[model samples]
Target: MVRKLLPPLASGFLFGMGLTISGMTDPGRVRGFLDIFGDWDPTLAFVMGGAVVVMAIAWRVQARMVKPVFGERFSLPDRTDLDPRLLAGAAVFGVGWGVAGLCPGPAVASLALSPVYAAPFVAAMLVGMLLQKLTMERKVSNP
Candidate 1:
């Protein structure tokens, strides 16, 4: 169990450290990124670019591996095509991100440092997730 959890835990710790170092833990920095008409900050774009590069490399590495260090195999989402639900979700996510300036991962990480911002962010995120789940459940049941 320890072996199974260690890699994911280490990855999460590194991710949190990156968020902390890049000022992603700061809600004001994120809010500045969202602000286009006001004093805008483009630093978050650089951080996102860096993350994209890292994710591309990680994807390549994972593709080459037959099995993950901890798991039998990586279970990735099978969906390859976009649909209305996907598009709508993306739009909603983008709007929420633009307004709040904090994505879920960084928001959760920021909780350890700043509850004043993180608490509301997390609460909203939970509500959004719950709503999505309920909607999906209703659709599934009705259909």
Candidate 2:
């Protein structure tokens, strides 16, 4: 069990650290990034660009590997459809990000820095996740 969990736990810790180090956990910085008409900050773009480059390399490596180091097989998303549900969800996500200036990742990471401020965002995120799961499950069962 420890072996199975270690990789994910380590990865999450590292990701949180990166978010903190890059100042992504700061709502002000994130809001600044979104304020294109005003004092827009470009740090998030650089961070995202670096992440994209790293992930591109990782994907190339994954293409060469038959299986992950700790898993029997890779569990990658195969969805490519542009359905109404996807569009609605994306619009909702964008609105939430703009309003709160924090997505799920940065919100969760911000818990370590300011639990009081992060609590509401995390709670709302969990509620949204649960609602999505219940909706999907009901659809699958009824269909």
Candidate 3:
């Protein structure tokens, strides 16, 4: 159990540190990025570009690997085609991000740094997640 938890714990800590260092925990910074028509901030774009480059390299590495360094098998998203449900979910996500200036990662990361912003957002996020879970369960059972 300890061995299994260590990898994800370290990864999450590193991710939180990156978010803190990159000003991703700052709502104003995120909102600035979204405000393209107004005074826009392009810092997040650079951050995203860096992430893309890193992930591209990681993908290349993954292609050659038989299994993850710590895991038996790699779990990856298999879906490629966009449909109405995906589109709707994306639209909702974009709108939520724009309005709140904090997605799940940043919201969770900000808890230790900016509780004022993170707390309410995290609470609301938890509620939303609960609602989603219950709704999905209902659909699964009904179907």
Best by TM-score: 3
Candidate 1 local lDDT, 29-70, one digit each (tens): 888988879999998989999989999999999989989777
Q: Rank the candidates by TM-score, best first.
A: 3, 2, 1
Error of 1 at 6 (Å): 3.5
TM-score of each: 0.83, 0.92, 0.92
RMSD of each: 2.2, 1.5, 1.5
Clashes per candidate (backbone, < 3 Å) = 0, 0, 0
Which tens-of-lDDT digit does each residue in 1-143 have in candidate 2? 99889999999999999999999999899899999999999999999999999999999999999898988999886657678899999999999988998999899999989999999999999999999999999999999
- Per-residue lDDT tens digits for candidate 3, residues 1-143, read 99999999999999988998999989899999999999999999999999999999999999999999998899987667577767887888889899999998899999998798799999988998899899889999999
How close to the true structure is residue 12 of candidate 2, measured as C-alpha lDDT? 93
- Candidate lDDT scores, in order, read 0.88, 0.94, 0.91
Q: Which order, best to worst by lDDT?
A: 2, 3, 1
Q: Judging by TM-score, tell me the better candidate of 1 and 3.
A: 3
